[model samples]
Target chain A: MIKNVYDDEVPKVVTIKETVIETPTVKTFIFPFEITEDIHPGQFVMVWDLNNEKPMTISVIDKKNNLMGITVRKAGPFTENMYENMGVGDKIGIRGPYGHGYELSGYKKVLAVGGGSGIASLAPLLSFYDNVDLISAASTKDELVFVEKFKKENIQVHECTDDGSYGFKGFSTELADELLKTGDYDIIVGCGPEIMSYKLLELSQKYDIDCQLALDRYMKCGLGICGQCCIDDTGYRVCVEGPVFDKEQLGQLSEFGKYRRDAAGSIVEY
Target chain B: MLKSNILGMNLKNPLFLAAGILGTTASSMKMVARAGAGGIVTKSFSLEANDGYENPTIVKIEGGVINSVGLASPGVEAKKEELIELEDIRDETPVIASIYGDSEDVFCEVAQRTKDYVDAFELNVSCPHAKCGFGSNIGEDPEMTYNIVSSVKDSIKDVPIIVKLTPNVTDITEIAKASQEAGADALTLINSVGPGLRIDYQTGKPILNNVLGGIAGPMIKPIALKCVYNTYKTVDIPIFGVGGIKDYKDVLEFMYAGASLLQIGTSIMYDGPEIFKNITDDLSIFLEENGYNNVTEIIGLSHEL
Candidate 1:
């Protein structure tokens, strides 16, 4: 079985078996990984390309086919490189299904909110969670991810767009606000920009529903060894204690939605 | 009781969160302090922000890791902002700013800018992988070590000064003695050992972006012990022993080898930040079993043998 990956082993090289264009800027690369029972949603893996190593969330985990996927949004030099150059049959080194993934057990109904590329992080949960209402929101209809994939699973999807070209025309938070007034969701899970997660946190509190957020920060050494992604106030390592944190846990982080450190550890106002 | 006094800071125990790992930020350092480390030594920073190397700057090997983080820092000015947040925790869990530079002037400048926020300065002149003659280049030579330490000591006085030495030198004691004579309050024996390599069989390329990086973790413990042991015999200053320390047994060996205190790095990757409390708890039990009242009593006991 593929157990919890530690840094002790060299990154396992896997060839891309399939590739799908999820959006105008987003693409999903599929590969056959053996015994991926250890990987979980919200947890990320360090993808080693020809040039460098970066952390990407596990988007698709198919146990039966033993296939895994990473949905990449073309952002920055590394991902832009992946968009322009990386393709099927290309060998990429992958280590870990690392860090804390979302814990959605015990809850009956889950209201999942994914903004833009963040749907990639929430996709693994859609397979595990039976009762899920996903609000897939984006700048435009073409920028949305994983809507059809969720529909194929009979998962209810609420499509949201900013320009009114889709079903629900508004911010994901606005659509989620309307849903919360009627939907009896026990838990509200969010993955997106810190601003979107922040709004989701507020909505969860407004409805008194439990909330979990998958946050993004500068990450290196997907293992907790490097303090690159550590958060404020509590000093919790985002690489270990989180990538996923509950509403109460999010309350401890003062830097959330306000700022985050760069590669130089200098604060950049968001 | 694990309470001890060394380097003028009243520490609850002898264990410190070593520099170079998890010492990157104020929040992270605060996390280690809360995890029960007696002191926090920050990752080395300098006058200008350094991006370090590209991707794959670190890789896992047999016993530990080879890291080429390239001394990535936000410069002393930006780093001072992080350190300012640490100042509140300084009285309880003392913060040690680990600073490095290309020359003595930069070293002293960094120490001067940060002396207010930190309880001590760990001069990381021994980082084996840093480029541009910054890390071990200055630490390997006794005269250069003296120049930096003395210059830093001259610029600052209230805070303790620590020179973290590299083991790749001909005789570590020469550098240790130079640090002591130059007014360093203490010494930290050994940064990571060799600028080692781990080549990918598929691509035939080194795993680290820098190709070579310093080796750290369990394999280097004995080497660290010996460095601390030999330097202990030559210098009067207390030594902060670090290298592949995983548990309480390693802690005891370091104390016996003449380290008055300890720092745990690298192994924090294997275990979590909880390594501090785990080792300290086991150490307390070990001390109780041995009829020791204070951990200080065990320091340098191996010397008499």
Candidate 2:
């Protein structure tokens, strides 16, 4: 029998923490650790937005001054609740910096491609790898996030929208394809819509550029023990072993770009 | 000064943290040491890299938990960093490395690789919820159990080895004796029970990602005690009893049932990391009040009846 690693007690709140919203549906949450600790860019926190029954993975936009910032997109019930109810100085339970993260060494030039809310998870990496070229996409011009945030760093911001309201009237894929054609980047890191990542990974592979994709699988316990966020492959778990997996590894899984599974391994497509 | 032993390596205290739950890293292991645990065993790592199962692998059941963690690990090579770091912690706490493998060769290889870092070794032959060809399959059979344990014993000459057993077997005593004869130094009995499943009535489906899981915590205490009780009658080697033990009373029951030392597992999940301090403090009180000078006096006290 598999042993259960149980830690269910929710820590009581002493003070509420807050993050400023960059867009109407997108906001960043700042968590100052009670204990002094170091967190990396790719490692995520299991944010238990009290209104929901389970925890959700919010991106760590930055970890400095002993505080970790999570960027969230209001898409589902959990995010909606978090957007409406959560504010600065409102406390919520946060556990983890769990799972393997992007190997931030050996690469010279890198590109970060994010779609919609996916840009939040990649912001920290951009800060870490200052040389990164960031391409962000949304459905419309108003939806474009982090434009000012990236401008502060003087990094190149390539924006794309479906309705041609922004810099490019296409998707991040078109921008990424143009960048890949330059043959200057050593690595391509992406997170966002599955199709966007899938297209970027394919393009990277064609150019023989190393690519890493962070997948958003359903999770319960952020620990590897919970099998809720398993990528369908031989011995792959997104929560523990990853949220970040190699593009080659992602290519091997059949359900890489489609629906996800619940606790029972039942696939539910979005 | 706190002389005790498991497998064969002399331990200062019998209170080693069980595998998987809290043994993932050196910091966590160091935290366990600081919390007053005598020793620490690492979460089981496999020879090859395994992502194991996905999230929601564990869930709460009444009195305990039903979990199908699928033995997620960072693979052996990556885990060496954590093992090496344990040497730096300023404690004489003997580190026991718990490892799992599909075959005898893998066990032997990992033993050889990790032998220098740890004081002793635990071949996890009894993970109840492991997939076929891994955990319980090797543990349930006398010959297979013997092979896995003996192979490690042959490879690691200096360190003592403990073959952990699962209670799911119909006759655990036979497997215990087989491990002893095959060169096992001691035995750690009862590595969780039941590839049990809990279904959520509201969802009309199972709660865990893997529908079936191993049951631990208070629910398996009686069965684990029974396994230790039955094995005592057949094996002469000292037993390291573990299962559903939450306090000094539970530890005492194992000692009376024939366990020389005890391991605390699932309770740490329910009670928090302070469980080690709680158990030891309670034990100190229980020992002084019971007119017992030392813990050894109570081993197999139940057999006197």
Candidate 3:
């Protein structure tokens, strides 16, 4: 009857309560019962679809009604299978709520930026901060997700699309840079592509604002054991030390936006 | 119940975290020690910082994993920071530094730099995917193994030296004997096997970024056991057996095969850090049930027949 996911390595089988298609490529899966472990906004959980296991950020955590949700984009073989084979009531394996999440306790005013499916990890931060600004970006208006949801949460929203099909015409990082100059926020947080995060880190340094970022890397184990997710030079495992890191820590990374290793540990251009 | 002594260092148990897994950082290694490991063998490091290989360093096969991480390290100076962090646990939990280099001078230099920070040294002469002349290249030759181990041994007499050997060699016992004759206090058998390859069905490209990588997991357990068994018969020093250990049954098999201490690597990914605690508990129970006084009783029992 142990409730903590970290107590066991084997994944728990949970029934899919519902599925909300946020965009053509992204969907939020709802599980019936709350995983009793305390989970934070930016932390993630590993989803085992029998074929493979991949980490997905926990997009929604509803503790009161016994519900938890993970937002996933159809990125590869594993996610593609999730979109095609999974349905309401279908049993899937899940473990974790792993890694450190966003720490927003002391900040007075905060701005959060997310690009594409990266928005999923930043969505829950809105609940923790009363004075917050959020930017959701995608390639096009049709692909921009959670806009209506953020609006409903009474937070200010800025939507960006690459094709000029949405609110801002440029990339989300450009918009974030503009905001950094105009706003007097004490803290900034972001999740998205590495390029966007790298830009945000630069802006944070330029604006003298503390910034935290959620990173993605190739990981076999969500725990810190596997060195696959380690960042070059720093040797920090994104699975353990991060997935969420602040400005000071992100500064030490040499490969920030330039490159990333593929599944085979071969470096590829980011 | 699992307590044992290897190379004059007292361990609470025979299970130690193998080199190159979670031992990259002090905090991570400390976490594993807190979880129940008796000692920690750090990820192999060299004199200069190396970026190692690009991703796709590791891939999953049916029963194990292949990795070509290329021994990515932050060099001896940066690694010293992590070793300093482990200094507090040097008394209760032994910290063994695993170092590698291309020549005897390089090996001696790394050992000399790190000797003060750790309880012992593990010469990583066995990494299958390491660049030419560094890992198995130095270990595959008896004279090379003797030269590297003797050089390292000469540099640090205060701490015991354990030479990690490769199984890809023609005869592992020959290399083991060479290391022992060269004054190595202990030996860690079978650093991953093969320059194994896997392919992406769609791309028709090799799965590992390096094209070929060292293999480790349950599938290599039998081979590792045989290596340890044969080497134990050839050498007098304690053997540190590693490769494909997942549970207590594997631990017993290794112990009975003449491994004085055991190292768990790939299984830590599948079972998490809890694997240490779980295996120790099961081993304690197994010892009591079988009327064994301690873990040392089973060492080399398989050779009795």
Candidate 4:
């Protein structure tokens, strides 16, 4: 059974029950114990690979079987270490189910957009909401993940590949724009590259649709004190106030798609 | 219950959110106030926007974390927006703008630009990891520290000027005396300590991108207490004690060590914004248990020995 970590700040050692290789870079590590807290869609947990603690979204939460899962892409040092060395039964520290998740209760029809590894974050949302139009995009056909999982659940899925290897030969935002014109979606939820989310923000405004975008930023302490995850000029902390933000809130951010601060707090082109 | 006054600004308590930790935005600043800080010091800003450094700016070590954020700021004009938001909360929580610059004139310019939106100015001459000739470089030299503080004091009228001092020096009181002589209304003791480093065993490279950064957290608490304890003897102005402060016990220690106000930074990372209220509540209980009616009764009590 996976050990449950009680504290928000302290890490609890949990045994990895299974590891599923989703793609070349992305993998899902499942834990045996249930996180008793109600982890909403778009919420994340800080995983400690012993080298460093990093934030990752909850890709799967199985309460009945007492299991939890997180999908990770080998994007940085910490994730790369996990991909290369970690295996089932390997004990890794996990803390928190932090941040406000997607508020998907009132919406009748919804559109979900996921880009690259962002599909993992969208998976839980698709599971919770029945009427979701899912768009999964990747750089290549093989890189596209969770296509079969969505199909198995009988959810309608749209695929997009930047290299034109799959369903649509364009960006996910472009596909979302095309879908927005025809489908009447009450709310659009997205998690991906900043540029895509920024574009989605624009399209949401253009289409007059309510949208929520899950944002990523450099975070230290997930509990809102470390200002590392702050958005430019606006001062909203992605760790606390977001990681998931509605269209109106994202509009106020000046650095949305244009820039992001590095770990050193240096602004770099996103 | 723990009301205190420092530099003519009234405070509900001695606790403040230190600059450069979580003071970047007005919303976060207001959150800190709502969480129970007597005042909020903004993340240090300059005359122009600075990108700071690259990735791996802050690394957590055993005792604390080392950060070389390089003072990344949105410049004063952009920072004014956050300051304006802070103005709405100024009545509940006083706002202090922490400003840093390369020269005395630049410091004066930033002070002039931001003076209207804040209750006071904290001259940041003590950040150990900032670019050369800006942070500790200006602070380490008595004459330079005097020049910067006096220049800022001259440029701004009616606003209290607080000099934030570095602990890297051999004699902190020397610098503290210099700041007092130069007309500083108050002082915040000890920025982070050392251009510290943490090397990754597998990579065999420094963990921080800047190679070296200032250390803040539990490791520096003793040093900060000592700096405040000693500097209180040298300067008559109020001292804002900061460094590794975590709980109500640390608050009492700082108060006994002669700090009129306490600034919390690294602890906020571990405990979150609620730490202010937690510490304040616990402190109130400790004071009542000890039969102390006012927090000032214990200020500098250790010096009597």
Candidate 5:
């Protein structure tokens, strides 16, 4: 048997830190793990209360802040517990700075795109670079929370909303695709809904925009052992090899931007 | 402590890491050893290279993982390089080469090629997730299981042969008896259960591309223990128990169920390589506290009643 380092147990707590609630569905829980002294952008930490099964993917927003936080959506049992029960002073279990992050260098101008809760994963990538353009879309203005953070960093911000309650009247993919076709970018980095990321990749491929996507999947074991968070066909375990992959590579995976499974191996409809 | 001989090979402890979880590479096998495992078993490799299944080969159900790795391997020749690397790290820690194939010749050839590098050979004729031509088709039939095991036994020398059996049978003892009748040395009871699959709710698609996978981890622990307990009544050879063993307590249960040794597979994924050390340390304490003289005394202890 191959030796797996991280298993399904709770990891030792490094530190319980805090961040402000930028919005109701998106509050950043800051945790500083002494175990992870050196973590890079695009790497994420799994956070969930011991009483719950839902794991939050907290992006390493500020490695220097000693306060890496995850922005969560009130979706299910785990998140509900995290939201209703968790506090700024409460300590929760954290495992990983796991998964592959975005490829950032060797580009003249790049675009970082996000949708809703997906913005939490892109924060570090945007914070690490100053020359990049930050394009984001949400359901409404109230859902648009990270604009000030992007503006504070002096990163170009393109905001869009579905109901015209914010910036553009359409989706972020539309705005991203238009700018992508100008042949002005070397790479486009994205994370959010699968359809959104998939659409971004589709446009990038059509317009020949080099792109990388931060994938999201359920990870029961932070190490590659559990096989719960496997991506399609590549036989690549997201917890060990990557949560990031090139768009050209993404096209080859059979279950990219997909959901969880039922007993019969069929995709469960939401 | 359980200081016992499996197939005439000495094991400091009877606890081993089972095949397939992290056994694909030499590094992974070495890591399990460093974590206090007495032995290692490589992922099931075949004579030819197989890609296995795509991502989501494993999925989390309530109690275990459903894996359909498709027996992904780099084939025999490439696997030899990994076995050679294992030779450098060779110590009292035994690395059991687990091999599977479509025919008896294929099994013998693989056994012959790596016999010198490994401490023992585990014939994987019972992988539940393997396709139509693979896995249990050859294993379920007593005659075929006996023939394939006999072929490898006839070809390979020195290294003891262990046949890993599937639990998806009506009478596992019959299979064990047949394998022993064909000259098998030792047996590893239970691979995964079911050609199981998981589905994605939103996309209305199967979670794994292969559609069906082997059920492993904690989910099948009860069934595996039953198989070991039942097989012990019929077979005299040592049995290596594998299923969902999370700690030393689980290992003890396997021993009570008639397993001379136990292996940790899916548990490694959840707990990391430290599981070996963690369980060993805990077992030492349990042994001392419980006033047990040795681990061997517990083997089939429950059957005495």
Candidate 6:
């Protein structure tokens, strides 16, 4: 695939154009971005809000409007700061669109699944391609991100929430497994919890279907020099080689579903 | 002819990925090894876990970056897994563990734990921004430098010791000589040059969480060359040059200044890991064209002149 590589370590100041409350826990912050690099879905940027910096996947890529958006889940200190003080007209810095994005061509049918805020990375795929369906999962109905927008786009939406407060009760992989039984798909795209991706990977292997999974790990230098985001086994930097990996690539990672390193590089099993 | 065997490690070339940038994991170190680095230096770790600084640990300036990662280490226990992974590639690429401590006891303890995996240990006594007397506090003093070097060098079995010295001192050669006397196998000339600070014009505040960070990149090359050149003349051991090496030309200058082994850091921040292959390939082309037999012939050319 002809992927766009937009990576600059120097932080570029950008004004916040708007912010959308996707859910109670998630928000999509829109900003005016010069689309110089031919970027695609699943590529992320390091967002610097003056006080702190964190990696956020590009959720909205509106080329015509010259605008971009990042959907953030307010889970940690960085996100908490954004929710409390950041808004329209507030200036922030972005330095990448780092790592390889999902490859969209040469596939007839695709099943894209996202859990909670993980759907943000897959949101752009809906607009980038055709004949692709989505499995949007979260803990509760209010927690499902980008569902209304996906519904507006008239694409197939399979909603699954763990609390049975939304669509299919239980895990997103369970819903995906049932869907695989019901229909045949060329590729299954997953982004969310590592456990869900692991289960989906097993399902893909079981049904003999190809898959792509996006990974989110503790990273320091989103530029790939820190080695904080490097996965075990292949030693591939998640910042460069992936945040998204195919079924074959995902299989090479021993730490994919089992465990990951904390901020201090200590092993923490999932 | 770019290959060299130094201090028990067979190097495929004279180029290595410096510590603190991308040396956090075994997988990452292996990635660098596959990318064509002669050796790999794991990021500095200690006896206990340290969170380091908060956000804004690194920032870019004109010539290079000012970073105070605060020597964030996962501790010896956690980092041992990464060091152990390096054993698989010990033949093709030797692994160097860059370690730090507030005293000689912690230094020996950390090396003792992970000594089995790494081929050598690069003492990180030169980090200008490390807090609580952990880094430069010991390096600046000749006695402390000798004490730590001797303590760790004496305790670790079969592993060579390379002392990384800071240029932010009255005379680096004194520390270099002390390290050599204390049984250091080699010396790494000049860690980051400054405890520099960058204040954002927009916010009127410091860019780094620690307020001050070490300076690295092309800006510190001349100083690094001076240190390498001076130390090479004083000490009997070899020198590892590390400061703002961006391209083959930079590596060439470092070797000429008396650095037998070279490390590439800060530049790898913006440039990809491919920098290793690019620099090595270009160095090879330069060597072939210049009619030099190998990389070893060029060491200390400036000093001879």
**Which candidate should be chosen as best, given lDDT against the real structure?**
1
Q: Predictions ranked by lDDT, top down?
A: 1, 6, 4, 3, 5, 2
lDDT (10s digit) by residue, model 2, range A1-270: 123434432322323466667788888777766423355566776664432334444454434455566677788777777778778766565556666667758888888888997887777776566677778899998887777777876767888998898888888888888988885998898888888888888888888989988888766565443334656533355766678887677777667787665533334575
**Could you give candidate 2's per-residue lDDT for residues B1-305 as a string of tens digits?**
23564455556666888887656556557767777888887888877666556534565556777777777766687677668978964246778888999899999888888788887788899887788899998999999998888778777889888889999988999999999999988888889798887654433445565667898887788998999999999987778899888888898899899998888876765455678788888787888788887778888999997
Better of 4 and 6 by lDDT: 6
TM-score of chain A of each: 0.95, 0.88, 0.93, 0.93, 0.87, 0.94
Q: Which stretches of candidate 5 lie over 4 Å from their true place?
A: A1-41, A44-153, A156-223, A226-270
TM-score of 5: 0.62
TM-scores for all candidates? Answer: 0.97, 0.61, 0.67, 0.74, 0.62, 0.93
- Please report the TM-score between candidate 1 and the true structure: 0.97
Best-to-worst ranking by DockQ: 1, 6, 4, 3, 5, 2
| Candidate 4 or 3, higher TM-score | 4
Give per-residue CA lDDT, model 6, range B33-113, as digits (tens).
888999998899999998788767776667777788888879998799777777889899988999999988999989888
Q: Residue-wise lDDT of candidate 6 within A1-270, one digit each (tens)?
A: 101122224567788999988898788899988765578999999888876788899999988888999998999888988887789989887878788999979989899989889889998887789868888999988898987777786767889998999889998988898998988797899888888889889989988989998998887767667678888988888988899999888989999899998778788898
Q: Model 3: runs farther than 4 Å from truth? A: A1-224, A228-237, A240-270
Q: 4 or 6: which has the higher TM-score?
A: 6
- Cα RMSD (Å) between model 5 and the true structure? 12.7
Residue A197 accuracy (lDDT) in model 5: 85
Clashing pairs in 6: A4-A38, B217-B244
Candidate 1, residue A61: how far the Cα is off, in Å: 0.5
Backbone clash count for every predicted candidate, in the order shown: 1, 14, 12, 2, 32, 2
Give the CA lDDT, 0 to 100, for residue B245 in model 2. 86
What candidate 2 gets wrong by more than 4 Å, as runs, is A1-54, A57-270, B1-10
Stretches of model 1 off by over 4 angstroms after superposition: A1-7, A151-155
Q: What is the C-alpha RMSD of each candidate to the true structure, in Å?
A: 2.1, 12.8, 9.0, 6.3, 12.7, 2.9
Interface RMSD of each: 3.2, 10.6, 8.5, 6.7, 11.1, 4.5
What lDDT score goes with residue B9 in model 1? 92
